[model samples]
Target: MTQIAYFEPSYTAHNARDWEIRGSYKYPSLLGDLHTMAKITLLMPTLPPETDPHRIMLETNYDVRFVALDTLDDAGDANIESLVEDYATAIANLEPDIVSTLNGRMIGHNFALARAAKAVGKDFVYRIAGNDIATQIAVREAAGRPVTGTAYLATLIAQERYAAEVARSVIVMGGTERERAAGRVADPSKIHICRRGVDQSHFTPAANASKSCNRILFVGRNSAEKGIDLIEGAADMLAKTRPEIEFTVAGDFDPRTEGNRHYLGFHGYADLPTLYQDHDALLLPARSEGFPQVVMEAMSCGLPAILSKSLFEHDFGAGDGVTLIDRDVRSIVDAISSWHDDDSLFAKVRSEAIGQAKEHFDATENGEHYHTILLGQGK
Candidate 1:
C-alpha cells in the first residue's frame, strides 16, 4: 500500500476521534477512507502542556497512526528552523511516499512542512483549506490595509506564491479556488477542485416530524468576519418585531441568553445533526470562505441556509438550497422573515436543500475523489 503522511496542525484530542462523536469529521472521514487504500499517517502538533497527547492517538482509528511533533507549537510556528529540521527528520523516519498538508499558507508550519517534504524527496501536495491567497488579499484590502504597505502581508503573499509554485499538486475546494490557483500555479492541470463532503446517513433529515420555521441556527466562529454581529443585530431586532423567531448560536463562545437569542455553547459532531433538524434554517454571513461544511450538514438535515451573497455566488448559484443575501442586519432579518411567513417556500427550500446534499455532497463519493487526487491517479 502507498504510504501517505497527512499534516494538519490544528488536529487535536478534541477533534480527532475513531468513532463518530464531537466536532467536525471532514478530516477524519477523508483520512478514514484514504486509510483503506493507503497507509495513512496523521501528523499533528503536540497538544498544550495540560492536554494529554496520548488521548489523540487513543481516540484516533487504529488503522491510521497519529504522530505528534513535540518541537512544533499549536500553530506550528515555534522555532522555525528547529521545527523544519524536526519535521524533515520525522518525514525521513516515516518514509511516506506523499506528504500532504492543509492550508498551505505563508505560516511557518506549512512553509516548513513543504520544505521538509522536499528535503526528504517526498512529493508535497498543497491543499488550500480555505479561501485562496488572492481572495484573502482582497479581503485584507477591502478592510483598508494595502498589501504593499504591510510588511507581514507582503511576506505572506510571497511565501504562499512560492509554496503554490513548488507543490507537486494543489487541491482546492471549489471553482473560485481553481481559478485563483491558475494565476499562481505554473501548470493549470495540477490544480484540482475537490469539495468537502457530508455523510448523508449521519446528517439526514428528521424522521416523522413536522416542520416549524421558528428556530434559526448559527454554527461557526463568533467573530465579525463570520458575520456573527449581523446575526446578533438581526436576532435583537426580530425579538421585538417577531417574538416567535429565536436564534441559537453554537461554537467555541461564551453563552448568552436574552429574549429569543440563546447561545448553546460548543457542540460535538454527533449533536449537530439534531441541532440542524430542530432548527428551521442555518445562517452564515461570513466575509469569506472556501466551502463551508456547516451549509452542507444543515442542508443534509433538510434545513435551508441563508448565506453571504458575495462570498458564495461562485460556488452556490441560484436554486442550490441556499438563500443568498447581503451581509447586513436588514438582509438577514428579511430573509428569515420571508421563510417564516411563507410555508410553501420553506418546504420547497427544505426539499431542495436535501436534494442538493444527497446529490453532490455525499462523503463516500468525495472521499474517493480525494483518494484519487492524493495518489496522483487523476494525472
Candidate 2:
C-alpha cells in the first residue's frame, strides 16, 4: 500500500469519534472513501500527550493511523525553534510517500511539513478550505472594525503564497476560489476544485409535508460577515409587512434580544435534518464565503435559499434552490414575500434545488472524485 500522510487542523479531541460531535466530519468522510486505495496516516496537531495517537474507530471505515503533535499550536508560545524541530520530527516519523497538508492557521506547520516532505523526496499537496486573510479582512471591513496589526496579516499572506508555490497539487473549494489562488501560484494548472460535500440522504426533507413558505431559517456564524444585522433588519421589516413569516437562527452566535427572530442557539450536526424540515427557506446575506457548508446542507434538505448577490455570484451563480438578492433591506423583504406569494416560482426553485443538491453537493459523488485526485488519476 502506498503510504499517504494527511495533515490538517486537528479537530477537537484529535480523534475520529469526536468529528461528528464537532460537526466537522468533512475530512473523515473524504478520507474514508480513499482508504481502500492507499495506506492513510492522519497527522493532527495540538493534541495532549495522553491522547492515543494510534487509536482507530470502527465508524469511519477509513482505518486512519492518527499521529498527534503538540508543537502545532503557537498560542502565545515563544519557543519557535523548538516547535519547528518537533513538527519536522513528528512528520518525518510517518515516512509518507505523499504529504498532503491543509492550508490553515499556524504558518509554521506549513513550513515544517513542506521542509519534511522535501527532505523525504515526497510530493506535497496543499488543500485550502478558506482563505483566512480574505475572511478576516472582509469581516473586519463589514463590521467597521479596525485592523489590529500588520505582522499577522503579512504572515497569513505569506503562508498562502508559500503553500501554493511549493505544493504539487492545490485543492480549492470552488471556481472563484481557484481564481483567487491562481494569482499566487506559478502554474494555475496545478489548482483543482473539490467542493465541500454533503450527506444528501441524511439532510432530506420530510415526505409529504405541506408548503407554507413562511418559516425562514438562517444558519451560520452570528458575525458581521454572516450578515447578522441584515437578518435582524429583514426580520424587523417582515414582522410588519408579512406578519405570518417567522425567522429562526441556528449556529454559534445568538441574535435574540427583544426581536422578532427566534434563536435556536448552537445545534449539533444531528439536529440539522429536523431543523430543515421545520423551516421553509434559508435566508443568508453573508459578505463572503468559500462555498459555505450550510448552503449545501440546506439544499440537501430540499430547502430553498435567499442569498446576497455577492455570495450568489461567488458560489451559487444562478443556481437552483436559491434566489439572489442585494444587501438592501427592501430586497430581503421582497424576496421573502415572493417565496410566500409566488407559487410558480417557488415550486420551480424547490424542485430544482433538490436536484442540484444531489448532482453537485452529494458526498458520495464528490468523495469518489476526490479519491481519484488523491491517486493522481484525473484532471
Candidate 3:
C-alpha cells in the first residue's frame, strides 16, 4: 500500500481526544475510508500530551503521529529555520510517498510542513478549504493597499503563492476555487475539484418532521464574515412582525437570549444531526466560504437553507434546496418570511435538499474520489 502522511496541525491533543470520544464523522470517516486503500498516518503537533497515540489508534482505528512543533507561536522568525529542519527530519523519517495538508495559507505550521515535504523529495499536496487568501489579495489590490511590500499581509501572500507553485497538486472544493487557484498556480492542470461530502446515513430527515419554518438555524462563528449581524438583525425584526419565529445559533460564540434569538453555544459533530433535524431551515449569510459542511449536513437532514449570494460565486448552494439573498438584514428577513408563509415552497425545498445530499454529497462516494486523488490515479 502507498504510504501517505496527512499533516493537520489544527487537531491538537485535546481536540483529537474530543473527536474520538464524540465520534466525529468528518475526519474519522474520511480517514477510515482512506485507511482501506493506503497506509495513512495522521501527523499532528506535539501538544501538552493528554491522549496516548496507541489508544487513539486503537479506538479511532487509524494511525496518529506527533511532531516537535506545538503551535503557530513556535513558527516565528526566531525559530523558523530550526522548525523547518526539525519538520523535514520528521518527514524524512516517516518515508511517506506523499505529504498532504489542509489550506494553502503557507503560514506557521503549514509553511514548515510544505518546506519539509519538498526537502524530503515527497510529492506535496495542498488542499484548499476556502478562498480567504485569494480574496484578501484581491481586496488589498482593489483598495490600493500594497500586496508586495514588506508588510505582514504581503509576506503571507507571497508565501501562499510560493506554496501553490511548489505543490505537485492543489485540491479545491469547487469550480470557483479551481478558478481562484488557476490564477495563483502556474499550472492549472494541477488544480483538482473535489468537494467535501455529507454522511447521508447519519444526517437523515427527521421522522414526521414538522415543515413549519418557525425555527431558523445558523451554524457558524458569530463573526461579521459569518453575517451574524444580519442573522441577529433579521431575528430582531422578525420578533416584532413574526414573533413566533425563533433563531438558534450553534457555534463557539457566547449565548444571548435577546428577543427571539437563542444561542446553543458550541456543538460537536455528533450533536449536529439532531440540531439540524430540530430546526426548520438553515441560514448562513457568510461573506465568503468554500463548500460549508454545515450546509451539507443541514441539507442531508432535509432542512432548507437561506444563504448569501456571495457563496454562489464558489458554486455553493447553486441548485435547488437553497434561497440566495444579498448580504443585508432585510434580505435575510424576507427569505425567512417567505419560507414561513409558503408551505408548498418549504416542502419542495426540503425534498430537493435531501435529493441533492443523496445525489451529490454522499460521503462514501466522495471518499472514493478522494482516494483516487491521493493514489495519483485521478485529478
Angstrom error at residue 139, model 1: 12
Encode model 2's per-residue lDDT on 1-379: one tens digit a residue: 7778766566564345445433246555566467777887766664323443323341246666667766645522354456556655765776777787532444455655666566667777777776555677767766777545667677666667886788888887877778888998889998988875887768896685446688888887766677778888988988887877888887765546455688866667777888887887888887766777888888888788998776456566564778889988789988989878886777778888888888899888787877677667788
> What lDDT would each prediction earn against the true structure?
0.74, 0.71, 0.73
- Over 4 Å off, model 1: 10-26, 45-62, 74-78, 102-106, 132-148, 208-212
lDDT of 1 by residue, 1-379 (tens): 9998877554443444422231135456565456668887767674322243433543455365667765555332346678678889989989999988632333555667778888888888888867544445655676886654576666665666666777888888877667767887678899887766888889999985346578899998664467777898999999888899999998867898877888877677778899888888999988767777888889898888999887777677667788899989999999999988888888888888888888888888887888789899885
What are the TM-scores, per candidate, against the unseen true structure?
0.85, 0.86, 0.86
Q: What lDDT tens digits, residue by residue, belong to model 3 across residues 14-79?
A: 455444432345465455467666776655554324465443553457553444433343555566
The candidate scoring highest on lDDT is: 1
Q: What number of clashing residue pairs does each candidate have, in the order they appear? A: 2, 0, 0
Which runs of model 3 end up more than 4 angstroms from their true locations? 10-23, 47-60, 63-80, 102-106, 132-150, 316-319
What lDDT, from 0 to 1, does candidate 2 have?
A: 0.71
Task: State each model's C-alpha RMSD to the native.
Answer: 4.0, 3.6, 3.9
Q: Tell how far residue 98 is off in model 1, in angstroms.
A: 0.4
lDDT-based ranking: 1, 3, 2
Report residue 318 deviation for candidate 1 (angstroms). Answer: 1.8
